[model samples]
Target: MKKPLPAAIAGAVLAYCALATPTALAQPEAASAMEEMIITAIREDRKSRGATGLDLSVYETPQSLSIINAQTMQDFGLTNINTLLKMATGVNVDPTETDRTTYSARGFDITSMHIDGVGMPFGNLIVGDIDTVIYENVEIIRGSNGLITGLGNPSGTINYVRKRPTNALASSIKLTGGSWDNQRAEVDVSVPLTESGSWAARAVLAYQDADGWLDHYSNNRQVAYVVVDGQLTDTVTLAAGYTHQDNNSDGVLWGAVPALYNDGTAIDYNVSTSTAMDWTYWDTQSDELFAELGWQISDHWLLTTSARQIDYQDNSEIFYVYANTGVGLDAATGLGLLGYPGKYADERDSLVLDASLSGRFNAWGQQHQLQFGVSSARSESEGLSYAAQSGFDVMPPFPGWNGREVPRPAFAAPIVSAEQDIDLDRIYGSLLLALTDNLNLILGASAVDYTNDGVSYGVPTSASEDGTNPYIGFTWEVLDGLNAYGSYSDIYQPQYVLGEDLNPLGSAEGKSYELGLKKAFANNTLLTLALFRTEQSNLEEFKAYGDGDGIDDTDYSDDFDYSLYRGIDVESEGVEIELAGQITGELRLQAGYTHLSLEDENGDEARTFIPRNTLKLLMTWQPQALPKLAMGLSTRWQDDIYFDSAYGRIQQDNYVVVGGYASYAITEGLSVSLNVDNAFDEEYFSSVKYEQVYYAAPRSVNVSASWAF
Candidate 1:
């Protein structure tokens, strides 16, 4: 039986407070220092890039924003970007494949990503696999940011900030062990290269090997990162870094097992069940090199230049099942027929360059700021695929489907299956004008040009498009610590699908409207309320024939004319409320609630897999008496979701998940921590589609110890 939500929340809060109050009251001096440290951990003091590409405060930004700091990441043991995103406000994860995960905000799929303000391509796949150890913080903007991103989705954008080298020597090492034979070790070190602190270097390394709850599944990973910073002169600085990551997994599932039998009857399976064969495997590797240069031209003017190159590769072999209405397991043997055995390999490379100049001046007795920048990016991808010559004929039928009975099959020579290239160029500018002491206006625009060229199975295709987007916003100080703001931003994206005329679908365009109120308390806490709407027209939708007999559907290997598009108009609207920062000297909290609605031109709900109502709450407490101990708790809830499946429409019920963590300091430089996830062991589906459903992970425990010097 599940615990009642309200009762569970109340019990946890009361217990935590009871454990912290007495100890805190006994020691006032230690409590004062702890309060200051807690406040610093939860709040950011440095200026950061906002919607207008200017350094701004969270209370002054016109768009909805959320920042997750390094302290919170460590408290929850968030090792990857996927784990970090699960706790963010108004964000939902959609796991399409075992290795691919996508995020959605406000009913729209989020596709834009940045690292230090530079754009990154193929974010959906990269973000899920990247480790979080190298990042200092993550910033999310929950509305359109097309002025800076150029061509992008209207959903939102994510920016990852890396940790920089410190002039002083610092080092930390950690070891972890957890449920399911999981083991991990990591090390981080920073050192000063010069006595005057003019040069510095930093390095990070991590390794992990884990066994999954599912039978025959296991994972192995390794990562290495290094960075160097040099003060070349009094007014110039240079920084460079390199990162490499490799991951390998055995018994990776291509898709989930069938949800229903042939007669539309549900099939019950344990959460630990898997359909993958023992020989199935997936591997990925990535390498990146980046450099940045900064120059202080004058007191009010500065220039920055940056460049990056990335190489990524993926290889996989898997067995597939094409379950349909008539497919069913054998009654006598409980065995099902196999569909196909496939082998795949893919490689991608990207190069990006950016330069920007910002300055401030006085005009008409008022101060103003302006920034201008230009950016160019190019990406290329290639892939090869091979399948068993006899398809299902050479594959053995599943025997009870335990993932260990099937034998590997022979495959034919791989053929060049896919090749693609994309290039983007943009120039953008923004201006901030101070109309009055309490009123500020932001204006920005960008001109973008993009091209896509590809070849597949001896066929060639290409497309080119250009567009201009504008942004306007204002923030008014309504009171001493409260502000009112509104913004309108435009978006454009080139579609890759072909239309009825055999040419590529035209570019999709959209606009976002946002209005919000923000308040900053003297106690270092922030509260925000936001209302937003986004609309897109000329969106592409695929049209397939009932039988694979149409010309557009017959040529499966060609890149062009593979699908006919019917126009689509989509609208997504939502309201969000958030609170974050220190609530008291020894307590820190972050909470958010969101309500969303989405529809298409025909008034039909779109992206039905995403929930309409979601809530998240996280809190941490430190006791003065037990000054060496810190405790944390978090809760997440989501409303019911309805989506269509092959059998029929399926409605998933609402669910709640709880997590807790505690850390104890053994000495000045040594600490130990324990983390428990899904404490109530809630049962639910993490992702669903017409043909497959993935079950959520059950309860798990992890414990780690760290030492710093």
Candidate 2:
């Protein structure tokens, strides 16, 4: 019999959760409405400057963009970015580890993450899912971003806008419990430090714990955030904030299930089967602080400066499984999977700084906008490794095994595993020319100096680059509420792969071109259509795998994660269509579709591991007659993806995942919500790069109560 999915939550502080409010599912908006939204309904306002320092609207940004505000997140119970991004258009959330995720867009790996228009740098090979409670909204920019983001990555950029302190008193608490013993609690409070409201502070804290669908797996998370904002004088504003987070997962998979047998036949393991031993675990902790200064030099001019620092640490003791012989993996007996264990720890510190001056000036009898800025991002990573105890390899489940069959391995003396530094410094500026009342042109460029020094995992991680990249765009108001735009930008990404001469290769360089159209309708609605193409060379392609000594590297040919890289040029072209905003007084909607094609210099298809088509849709309805209730549904669909590896052909056919939610207001200050993910329980693989793959999670449900005051 299936176990009951119910639980009692502790701490019932009755603050309003703000659950039933009919906040418009606001999408990205243009720059014409920033001022009025400064202090009211800020979460519902569409203000995204993450693409360029200059303030611009989503339709005016000249790129494919998407935005999901706090209300949308709360409505859907999207407390984490992994689940949040899944409902976004043109994005692929690729899960490589149970606790980590990699995002890709436009057929390229995303390399940049930003908070409040500042770059956040991390050089780790492993990245965990980020909590979203500290953010007010999330903006996704799809395409090459080289103008201000120093790094010319074509995959796109993810920008998180932190929740600022509110001038008025407000408080909310939400408690949730559901399937697999999942439980969560969050508290938020904002208060004016001064009665005049010139000074304010806000704090938010969250905790979560849950068992897993995978046997022997359990996890817990904790997060805290504190922020203060104040108007020191009539024209000066200052803000400072701090955030801390911890994630721990036990009985985790160091390696996933083997997809194929030694005999080359597909092996289907039980959905609940986990290769992790009872003693294995992975954990990460992070803390960050930031400060910002804004000076209103004049009515139309402003100066802003910000600094941020983050300290991160991760520790893990993992066990790896592999085939014992040529025909070792026999699914029938499960005798072929052998285990190898390792212990690792990494401490990473990153800092980012930015200063910009922006203002409006009259040029040619017209008002024009411009911004100039300098920014730098630095990350240093150091790690320690311990030798594992002997005989640990023979302890995994074999003939008649259970999770506890093997004892925890003893570690030998710790040794330095890595010492590395990655830094990027940039000087950039942009100008918005008012060609006419209905026409505008934007010109921007950045001069960047990037360097990577030291070694990681015995490989020399040395690279230095200095160059200038340009960006240009044009937008025209074709009709009363429509816009047409075109954009071009340069792309750059450093490489660590060795060349034929055993030296590092040059950076991958490319160009991106995009043209699009957007329409704005009543009820805060937006529609967008875009066509884009990008081309690049020096993208490390597969080379021979050997000892991995920068010479004859010893590795698998299709090990995308560690495969040897050789310079290769590739091109990708795609089309995207999207819509966001209220469809009617009773309905709010957001949806998008993308079609992409990628090819190598040889005209052969490239990166077959990435799908060519994807679509996402989400909608909410609240009838005026039934003002106390609201409901929503979301869907994600993708084309098939396949990759050939040492283990054989790995393919995932096209599939769709659906989710639903509903909320009811019990009172003006209280509400409750029910959320169901993977509603149809569709079985599908979330990734296929490695021999061991992961199946998407099964259907899960959650119910929550929230109070807002």
Candidate 3:
């Protein structure tokens, strides 16, 4: 096994400590007025996802949490959720195909998502396609969040907060142009509807058209959002909002090209190589409506209720490739005889309702905070698929292939291949007790009811399960500005697969243990170090037999009673360290390092896509001599990973990517910015599977101008 920490990361740690130690030891009284003002600004920026729920600071929270504010998003040019996940600590983005992306944390894929603290399910091909322009900030909680997210994975939870209406009139407009014929425009405006400023409204619009580096690949996207906020009475408030998004893409690849030839020789292709036909396309449309009501019962008591409805649709026509070891593409002719052309259409509808009451009270001569909430979510989806009878095409392949020359194939009529309905209801309660001025205890529990009904390929199945999860933690003030904490949490997720007896498989369960230390400095900087371990059991594994007699020779589906069993067990252990906030009045920084080890029952490494060692750093500086100009740098480094393939084991070497950005305030209300990614132009594979591989983007640059009023 390779060493977990490399020399490059060690050097970075030394540099960070040298730069931060002096400021960390400085006295608050010795700071200048400008420094004090900057500290205040940092404090304001630290407030997150507090209005709806989980109103706690990073230093005060027992679990690991990271926040990416709007300012960081603009500085780094993180326009989409995928880019944001790449920058977040301990998170990995795995690209399965051109239109499908999955996120993993702590060796497990993340399935729990929330908008403004309301639970939302994330799945299918459209999960990563959501635009980030409408969000004010994003919060990532890394651990078992079952106490709040009920019937979810142990990997973690993601919460997005929407940009709300401003009390005062504000507006902004931006125009951008980048490499690959990328052009984008955005407009945001907020106004006070009433003279007294009791009512307000806001609107945001954005559009983008971009051409990819690969041959015959392009995309267009549009988004529109509007919201209204009103203070109905002296102690009551209401908000309503709607969002719509449409995305269309041409020449989307279903799978990457073959990695090896028929003669057992590795094939090397250019970075812009593509295997998609010009006629292939994928399109998605989504619409959402939400409303919230809040009542301030007293100075320390509040009640909130929220509801959301979503409708999503996806339509696609794709040409997929499958390359077997001994029958790969011909080396001399540059042609392959394996292809599958298909058409699919899917639609989903979802509705969610949530209500909570939170308050603080005096009990047993101590201060305590308590919260209770109930939520219900329902979703239904239907899909149709069509495929060619004999999926084989004669066309130029590999080095000399052009998508335009391949003729489109004919497909049969569409059939209902899959339909599903899922419903979940949960009730949860939490209490924070201040045992003393220096000691605190947290207690939480959730009861969840889940049901799933689905039909796949003419096979019908249904499952219903109920479970309760519990959580406990303690935080002690070790020093004047430092805290020590530990927590224990568990999660449960129902499985829909059936066993040989045709009964639903047992549910999967997991437990997490975490301990950490957090420190807050006078400059508003936060430092955190944590150790964690998660154990999962009752994972589903499938097995096939011949004639229902447990023989392995027969390969016919009709003769076999293929079934799933709950026997797999997985464990992941790791350490994480993070430092964030303003290091100085002119400099702002965010840096994180993570080390993970994942293993299954056989003690073999699991989840190869998740690197064992990862580091992420971002820094911004505004020189005193050039107050009107700001510059920043960001970098990410990860360890090597390997996956099993038909030919052999495939290994991807470790790599480091660096990016930079600069912005100049030309005038009071106008500014210009430039961003450059992959400054070193290092080539690496973004994703790799047994049959396909996706390459990362090359060097790219973008320039933008914005005006605010």
Candidate 4:
């Protein structure tokens, strides 16, 4: 199975062309040959569910759009969410803990995640690691999108388009082996339930077992998804599906390696080092059930309703190593290595319902679009903590440490420490008016009510908030292929984040403005340049790990469950430019560059750890000399970043990580690829939140075989 994969998932899913059958059970177009594979892989007409709720095209969205389609995923083997987001132009994926990650765009954390334009139950807080096998494409809309979401942030929104059942018979299988004993297998199949192809079902399953670059770290992940679609009537369609993802990690690092010495001197260690204990484990699972109905009121009108229920749970037994003062470790004698352990179980049940009516009409000699919707989401969470008796809590050796020599602590006496309920309700609508043949006016607004009630680890976590977010945009087609646009958007978010004092940090409000130019070409090719600014208050800033700030009282407990954050006010301004689709018949590319500046109300630099300049480049080309060969290159570069730590400043120099892939088509239906990440073996810190920081992975290689039909 040594071949080009998608020229064949592309050269099969394009196998069922015509996304036209809006009915879930509509027939899929039979895919053709690979002559236009590069162009087709770069763009999709149906990827129009972003920016506004009106399903506008990229040229009309008035915002930055980044898309990673299924063809790209199969080409690069981007089977995980974090890997996919890293390729997004303005987004950053921060892995603070071994098993937990936070995504950021512009200068703030990205809290919004949607499925098929419908908001997720709890923002971006899924319990398990996100697996991409179940998604058709991952779309990102940079800047505020309050018009499409009930809760909004300055960061962008990530919309995941779930893969549906195809009206035709299709299937694919993949096997991969990589560096560090990494192994993975995946299978995707679609079957027609009815002979006429009026009904269909699709299922995807995946499993991966891999060892990390860090010592003693390993991961085992599994995913299963199934969806069914049927035609109830000539104009009515029904679709339902379920998804399950499980992730279990062993020896997962909690915090990171301390960056400094207690004496205020910088300390550096090997990139492969880890403080995670050998016996520790973090296991999480997420299960969801969803249903959707669509009624075609007329050729120009459609009404849609969707509902979903989600259940998520996480259980972990983990350990943390830190200094007694919670600041830095001793340079000599390797002293003051304190060990902290905990046993935790958390569960969340969420219900979300959404309904909308969208259509087009002719008015004033022009065609206009309108969409209105109502949505409600409620989530209930429960958490239990078990007392951990750690005999190795104080004074352990640090030099030559890996955590394998450490003993696991005993846990007992579980107590219900956290119980909370969160709810959000909103009414939203948008209208796109064709004011003139060359100009358009877009208006939208959402009124949201957010409430939270519960107790978390002895802290009173409760709040009530209601706000209106309004959006306005203007677009003018300056030329036949160029459009100039400007937009204004606002954000209102209710927060449950805790501070160093252990109380809820409260709510946050923000506004964003953008002006940009878009150039569109044939085959959905797009180029965009944008200037944006934002002002926000009550944004949470990371303040080290643990409960107390060392100086706040001399007693630093070994409770690693509670991290610290504080509210702050900040202003952010940035410029971004991006390009997508084919540059030549043989080459297609997705590239972006961003320059950002963040400052506090007092004019002091804020969130200094965020890079001021970043650039992402991804491109693929099929050489004419070798018709069966495809090659691609990916690289991400950033400016220097620094963090003000307790003892001193932690900094990382500008660095670039490079990845490349080569695939050869063995046959039209099967392929093999060799992908090398960090091809140059560049080493840098992935994060610098505390005295401890994480090191980026070194060079790794994987060889994958795929079969598509």
The TM-score values for the models, in the order shown, are: 0.88, 0.90, 0.88, 0.92
Q: Please provide, for model 3 over 1-709, each residue's C-alpha lDDT reduced to its tens digit, 9 standing for 90 to 100.
A: 1111222321121100000111122233422432332222222232433311344567878888888887898888888888788888888887767778777778776777778777665341243267888988898888878776775466777888788777679999989999999899989999978775567788999999999877788989999999886656554556778899999989988867666666656678888877888999989998888777666565566676777778888999878665522455677866654555778898877877777777678999997878788888877888888756643554456765687655677788988877778888999888889999989898888899887887655556577789998888888998998999998888697765665555567688988888999999968799999999999987654443223344443112222223444457899999999999999999999899999999998999876767999999889999999999999999999999866565555567899989989999999989999999989998877775334676778899999999999
lDDT, residue 74, model 1: 83
Which structure among the candidates has the greatest TM-score? 4
- Candidate 1: lDDT over CA atoms? 0.73
Best by lDDT: 4
Q: What is the lDDT of residue 423 in candidate 1?
A: 82
lDDT of 2 at 18: 12
Sort by TM-score, top down from the best:
4, 2, 1, 3
Q: After superposition, how far is residue 575 of candidate 4 from its true place, in Å?
A: 0.6
lDDT of 2 by residue, 1-709 (tens): 1121111110111111011011221213443332223223332342446566666767677788899988999999899998998888888887766876778888887777887777764421345557898789898998878875876777788888888777579999999999999999999999978765667789999999999888788989999999886655555556777899999998877657677766667776666767777888899999887777666566566677777777889999877666654555776666666666778898877777778777788879898988888887777778788877653454343434457656687899988866777778999999999999999999999899888886645667678889887989899999988999998988877765565444577788999899999999998799999999999888765454333434322222212123355788889999999999999999999999999999999998888877899999989999999999999999999999887766578788999999989999999999999999999998887787566776778999999999999
Model 1, which residues run further than 4 Å from truth? 1-48, 126-128, 325-338, 390-399, 458-461, 496-503, 540-567
> lDDT per prediction?
0.73, 0.76, 0.74, 0.78
Q: Report the Cα lDDT for residue 299, model 1.
A: 50
lDDT of 3 at 549: 45
Q: Enumerate residue pairs that collide in model 3.
A: none
lDDT of 1 at 367: 79
**What is the descending lDDT order?**
4, 2, 3, 1
Positional deviation of residue 558's Cα in model 2 after best superposition, in angstroms = 16
